[model samples]
Target: MNTSPTNSDSDTLRVLAQAIAKLILRFRFSRSRFLTLLDEELVLQAKNNDPQANNVTLSIRTGINRRYIPQLLSGEAMHSKPERLKMILEDLKWTSQKHYQSGKVPLKGSFNTFETICELRASGTLTYKAILEELMKQGKVKVAGNKVEIISNNSEQDNEHREFARNSVEKVFYTVEEIIQTEKN
Candidate 1:
């Protein structure tokens, strides 16, 4: 994997930071809360990238408190159940694309089942049952008598959730464009 940051990556980071700053300002979010949330996100990202990642590794990589890593992973910190489920859904989508033969796949008797995918992506932090429950709640997956069917990848979420995610992404792009124009001027 190329670890070097390209110009585009740097620009994206700048825009992401600006958007986060704007959101913080708009919401008047406390600095401690922001840092905690950021830490949780970083920890999860690290775990996803490296399945062997642990509290010590995450602390070293993210400068977060080692003590809180367990709490964050266990959903005790900020209730990250939704985020965990979303990550599982993303992994399922990717795995399905790469391994499954069709839109529907078997729940068992396959290496790329939903449970196995969750086990691989979550690195044991998230349980298959938990992810299944969340997916069921969102109507993203259905369990029949024996097989499981993926209704959606959780990409097209509810309107409110979708709009919130879209706005956050748009804010980053707008901020980046503004910055580029300012620099050119």
Candidate 2:
């Protein structure tokens, strides 16, 4: 039995690593933090496979310090900003239902308005500009002369934008599945 990984295995690993790197960068995860989380996941898998497995075994297998394993396992990581952005968009959509007039809303006001809706959706965690930027980037909203028009709810109306959104969501799902499968082993 050949113990070494084949070329196909190496290529697959490289692609997986690239995907993980993108996720880490997009989510602003620090390398050390990701490594710690990975170590914790490895420990969990080890324990699942063999109930007698301990931190020392995990450290030996994952090359992470045994001292840090428990801390890593106990700490809860924050949810991804993109997921939060989706929630914010949903909140914006709900708020827009009441305020939308002729498919557009004035971007001026402190209450019950488009600007206020964005702020309320952000809940102070994201700046108004940041929220608008994300919405505009996704082609979900368009700004023109002090009016923000609802171009498409979640970019459903525009085929190009819809495809982009679909690809993005698919990437998130793929990454999640990959992580789960990795942990299972």
Model 2 sits at a Cα RMSD from the real structure of: 9.2
lDDT tens digits, residue span 11-66, model 1: 87886788778766554344566676777788888888887987899887777789
Q: Looking at model 1, which ten-residue stretch has the lowest summed lDDT?
A: 77-86
RMSD of each: 15.3, 9.2
Question: Model 2, stretches more than 4 Å misplaced?
Answer: 1-19, 23-44, 52-83, 101-103, 121-125, 153-185
Query: Model 2, range 55-120, lDDT digits (tens) per residue?
Result: 788677667778866765565552334455566556556666765646566676876556777676
Instruction: Judging by TM-score against the true structure, name the best candidate.
Output: 2
Runs with alpha carbons beyond 4 Å of true place in candidate 1:
1-83, 153-157, 160-185
Give model 2's TM-score versus the native structure: 0.44
lDDT leader: 1
